[model samples]
Target: MIHQSFLDLDYCARVSGCETCRTFRRAFILEQITGRDVEFLTNPDLQSPVYAVLRIESSGDRLLLTSTPTQKPSFAATVALNHEPRHLANDPTKSGARLTTDFQELRRVVRDCHDNHECSSRYRWSRRNPTWLLEIMDNNQVRLVRGPKSLVDYVVLSYSWGDPAEMPAAEWARIKGAGTKTRNGIPVPERLNPFSAWDLPETMRDAIDITKELGFGYLWVDNVCIPKGTNWDTEASLMHEVYGNAAFTLVASSSSKATDRMIKERLAWSHRSKAVKLRGKWLHNTQMPLDKIRLESPVARRSWTLQEERLSPRVLYWTEQRWYWSCPESQVAELEELGHVRPENKSMERRSPQLFLELCRTGDIEQLHEEWLDIVEAYTPRDLVEPRDRFLAIAGLAVRFYSAKSEAGGSFISEEYLAGLWRDNFARHLAWSVAKGANSRHNLQHIAPSWSWASLPLRMETKTKHAFKPSEHFRFISVVEEKEDSEKAMTGPNFTSHDSLSRGRTMEERGRGVKVVDVEGRFRRFVSDNAKQVSWDAIEWRRGKRVGFDFGAFPGHDLFARHEADGRIIAKDAHSGEIVGQLDYVVPDEALKSPFTPYVPCGGEKEIMCLELGESAMLLLVRNPSWGHQESYRRVGVAISYENRKGFFYGCETRTVRLA
Candidate 1:
């Protein structure tokens, strides 16, 4: 039973001929449904007394009718709904109010995006099979389901996990067991028992309820859907497809943690009369803009969510004020001002990775290299829980770039991945220096070879401004051949050839080795001790056109201290005194007994190698100490190698040699 006494049916019929009267009638219906008083009035600017248009305004809600005299008389309205004050109380669920009156419009937007958006057809990675989804079953239960069948519509949840320690081990165990169940010690393919919504955290429970409300039966939540341990790496690699293929990605932007609720109550007020009198004239104060509210959300600032948002074809942002819809076609908010202004036909250019992919199609290797560098610079500062996952996290983006290239009939230069650097552009790619404000020491764990940028824990920048510039004088000799480790390969997704996913090997499992090359026929070798201590020493120096002068204090403590004081320890040119290169050094743990102190020499002899840059050269100090049965070298420091008045380097015969 419902109350309808508030409506005057006979009075509504008497003035039904008037358009304003009809508008008031519709407003009255809304008031009845929402339990809020609704009024119909003319536009404040309209001065006509006979047929001025009417406007609808409630205490905290607004519906602007778009009907003119010449236009058909219809009740088409643009509604701007906000959360009620009671919803914002400490207990959000305690309020019995409806979540929103704009649910129909939200559903329409999603349907349009799915049916009309071009991205849905272009990005079909998510359509592939063997993918997992969390199916919301009857009785408030959830079951993990896998698919190799036809395309199924599913929703994905994007949220921050906050502190990892807060995750319940029991919930994880239940999910793990639910994936596979056995009856009488025999495995069976049956749905797992349903779990109550109360069992889940607030953010996830809200997401599950929203999914069901939107007519979606399946949902994907990373923590619950993704398996733990070794499977984490394999599942992480599929993040691109998982998000991109989703029919809708629900962004819990306002929630700071997994336990935080996405839907909450907030005070809503009319912005039409919020103007203040300033200097005698009324000046309306612009409410907090929509973009500001969106960008400032907790999830937007996170590192992992960056890829998730960009990859998803359709994203529905749930904020405190109102809902926001973003897809390939357009971005719209409940508020008129927040809606996206349709762009010209060049919307495709705005699509990320697509833009990068287009660049790849042009065969502009230089531009591609530059774009890769930009991606690296942007991604380096993000926080990571495991340092070893640095390369794994970004591998999906690389896969997409290569996939686009292959589609354009472009051939890959090389299939081998050298840590983070590729062997195809070895010469230019190897010219990387430690970026400013990055860590100055190397990680003790052997994540990558010493020559690769991934070897050090610090952020890196390219030494040369132009990545594709030709180095005619340099020639690559040979790289040490290391076989992939089968044991480590099982820990993560393997990086195989682009054409054959089954044949590729993971970069983590690849053998460790250094690339050997020659500069102007002169073979220069960089030696290291266990890949951690890789450096070169300055054996000889020449000022101008004079013959080379050998310093008696070479490899000694006093000379090392003097060079360090002069700031030549890094890549400072001895002649011009310009800082051109960077270096990373890790001191041995003090607890361990070692023969040598910092910059202090033991009985071991030191060596040096010259690394030629464009117009300058870096003199690296290398130390090869015999510890046990292993022969290893450690990099101490680097100084600028000055050119003589005659030429940059003394003529030397080219020779081939192996470097470890």
Candidate 2:
């Protein structure tokens, strides 16, 4: 590309003719800033490639800029100008951030987020301090800050733990020792007499150095402060507070592991254009897109970091591409203009910090669970290092959720946490199953109740998006008897219901938008039996009427209808060759639908039971419980009937069964 001055660039474009002006014109018009379109808006026609934006300056620089080309024009396209060039740093290595305009505007955006955004202030500063904080001293020696409040503001580091086996023996020993020493408690401001930035991991070293440069006295790098093998019981539970209260979080996104550097490398981006020298000054372009900021980096894929980013008041990230600041309102990329983004393009999950407060204020339980399902959709798919961490990894986020739901002097919902799910929404919450194309596995340790998603290294799907249908399928089963759960818990025994069962007595009831009672591990999924096979002991049929087919639900997980309605496997009764129920697989594999004989390893054909969730949705519970939990049952799959079967679920086996 030829270098052209800012003013002359438009002239050359007009003289040479325009290529994307039509698209740019339509996009610019959407901004509603200018009434008419112009022949030459700027020297380079930077049509939006991802989301659209047209820059119009607010300062003395009455200049206009453009974005790369996009698929089609958008309603959100806006006319805006890039901020001062000071925000884009000439040297990333020296600045330790992306889009480092020497951090001139960076500080302002940070201040605006901290001082102005209430969502940021309310949840943040709630935790007085983390168990320990590393104080950067004038001599460059890092001192530990623990107990009580010595510092009001500090930065927290969110990075990857990486593969410990790859680390050196000596360094690994130090990391393990750090956890043990801290657990027993350490002296105040214990100066690690020999500790220096050089003695730390590359990511930690950069974080500490950058914290110093940012003029903060303390930085909380987990590897050094908390370390590997530390009993999370002490620090893990305080995650929401630790990250939330911090002045800001410094994310080492580019660094894959502790050994990787956080200074970042930009040599790969040199080939592309970013700036052109005009009158001995660089007229820079806003190149970073909104989607590129949070969704792409490797750190975003880690389970703990997802909660870290969601809980933090403000996050300052150093990805391989650029540095950006994310808060409740919007994300500010260093090189781009302030908030050069289309609000619609921002990820809702990323807005969790602010959304958390708003959800709590509304005091609505259903909406909160929906938000949780959204979190599960995103969080469960990401990788987990320790299978048991399914709950702990999200413990911080769960705390916020529990606190939000339980805000008004506690509720039946908040106090009851069975595995990773809330008791009140257990029915609707049970609509998750392994998403298609996801190679998920059940944990050998059963770290979670078999009824919870936490039991597996989750990659799940739910019926809300797919929308389960109950009317079209259920054949109507009768509950032979009704009795209090006689199986006494070591103490009090109670009833937990599907989020949809409040008005389930009527045939017209679609199981949504109803009052809920706290329940957990009451039911699970149903499995289909190809033959006229029926677990006679599992089902108590009403006099002349046969119980309908519940051939789809299986144990250990849940799934959706719309998500995978492509097709289903036909489940038939083994004895009569009767078409009973159908099993919906997450993926529409031809083989699955071809012969819907979903076998229960080493066991013969069997039928399952269903618990009504909403009008159309019923959780399928295989009558068989695992590992001799005879009085209890495990979940399998969820069943949705398109046709109304309000009467179908009536006359069902009403017994006090436990979910083990």
Candidate 3:
């Protein structure tokens, strides 16, 4: 008879010998389960804890004890004790035995993702195979194979490398030496077996084991498969194809770094099968559910993983608590019964390019804009080793979105990509504001133009209620690359401006040629044409203080108010006092006459531009608080006039002026 005692601290203490031995054994067990070393355990400041339940499985003839620190100690004990095994008489017809418990759920999830037509049909697999795959042999030896033509399946690993400072010099040397044979122009395959399996990062070892268990002949890990240096740029660009074409992507979600293990500490009894006689047949029961896992894991928070998660047709996300399966057709946990769906699954279903085409058909451009903003907000906060990879990281999604637009008849979408912003809806899309309490980093290598949100390395928010009206009169003369000799256009690497008439000139030259004018001529003309008399009763202003106005006081005032930093405005709905929308004051071409006209305030350098909302007209004020301030400006306020204010600007004279 076999007996198991969970959370058996006394038994562990007895088996471990003295106090010193017990502590050492506990640390070693924790290190084995969590892939954390003694240093990580000693670091009190680390967020993840080291405590876990210890399970001891024993029989009359033999004693077996197993405990992995990945499982929470408290819950492990409760689950183990709650599902105690029931002894039954053995019968020849019914054998109480099954296959290995390791990765049972994983195998099922992978099989379902592959076999299900609804899920597998969505993945667009490429005919061309990767140049190399890290092959793990039966002996647990790992080697790089050059073009395995017979291999039709491979798994990709998505994980983080821990802080560089903590990485040992020996490990760094091993990583650098991984492909040294190929580095000297040799075509021979490089073998990684010289390095001990223990030396490999925890994540790498786990990924290798997972790949083998999943019946895959090959695995692709970025750090090992791709050589570092100049070749990295070209390889990095192919990320979309690499991840998108994989059989499935394995996400080490819970582990922030390679050393952190994905599996959680749990009792051995919890995994042990509980046999029961149901009617005439014996039944085996175990607890395995998707509910224990979390969607927002540390791995999900990474900037690079965003594309990997979206592009891959299938993903097996291993978190600290549970395992989750996410494919285009379904996203659920191991124990979640079929038919039970999560909202995230619905969101994932809508991720395809087909959904974007539907939006285009309905002319739901605002919803599309909102979706893009959501992506931007999620991507911006994640960490990126190279800040320049900002646009590149999300470029895959942009490509898909662009393709969707093409499929929906490109007339509705903008062909020009101004850095990260689209040209067709340029004005309204420019209404992005920096997240409050977030500061923009100055030395970002300036990969984008100042006007684009990508130029600022800060989280951004977009306005909801307020819209930037499209102006047919306004023309995008041209956008030039800031770098003189470089061939890469200012428009993202994946995009090119279709307009040949728009010349690629220097920024200074661009500024010198463009101009803006106010068609209303003067404030008196704007007032006379719009209304019988100027409504001074509702208008109020302070001489020197920060500008303030009541939206309620000015009845016909079209300009909506919002906080400049986060673009959040107090909602008009009296029931819910919620703030919404992101607003940024845009300064139009200097060639255009000021929309403020004769009402231009004194003391500061004031610039005015037409604030176009969807079928609405308003005015925006950008003021340099002090004289001689070249770059700094504050968005003072906004004002709206009654009726279609476009009539006032009809036959407006055009002027050539520069815009900053």
Q: What is the C-alpha RMSD of each candidate to the true structure, in Å?
A: 15.6, 13.3, 12.8
C-alpha lDDT (0 to 100) for residue 613 of candidate 1: 34
Tell me the tens digit of each residue's lDDT in model 3 across 282-353: 323223333322224556446777767666767777654345676655665544533323245765434342
Q: What TM-score do all the candidates reach, one by one?
A: 0.59, 0.63, 0.58
Best by TM-score: 2
Judge candidate 1 against the unseen true structure and give its global Cα lDDT, from 0 to 1: 0.47
The lDDT per prediction is 0.47, 0.50, 0.46
For candidate 1, give the lDDT of residue 570. Answer: 25
Worst 10 residues of 2 by lDDT: 504-513
- Ranking under lDDT, best-scoring first? 2, 1, 3
Candidate with maximal lDDT: 2
Model 3 is weakest, by summed lDDT over 10 consecutive residues, at 517-526
- Writing each residue's lDDT as its tens digit, candidate 2 over 58-81 gives 542322423333433322332223
lDDT of 1 by residue, 117-217 (tens): 77577655645633566788777877766653877888888876654445577644443343334455332344344556656677888899878877899
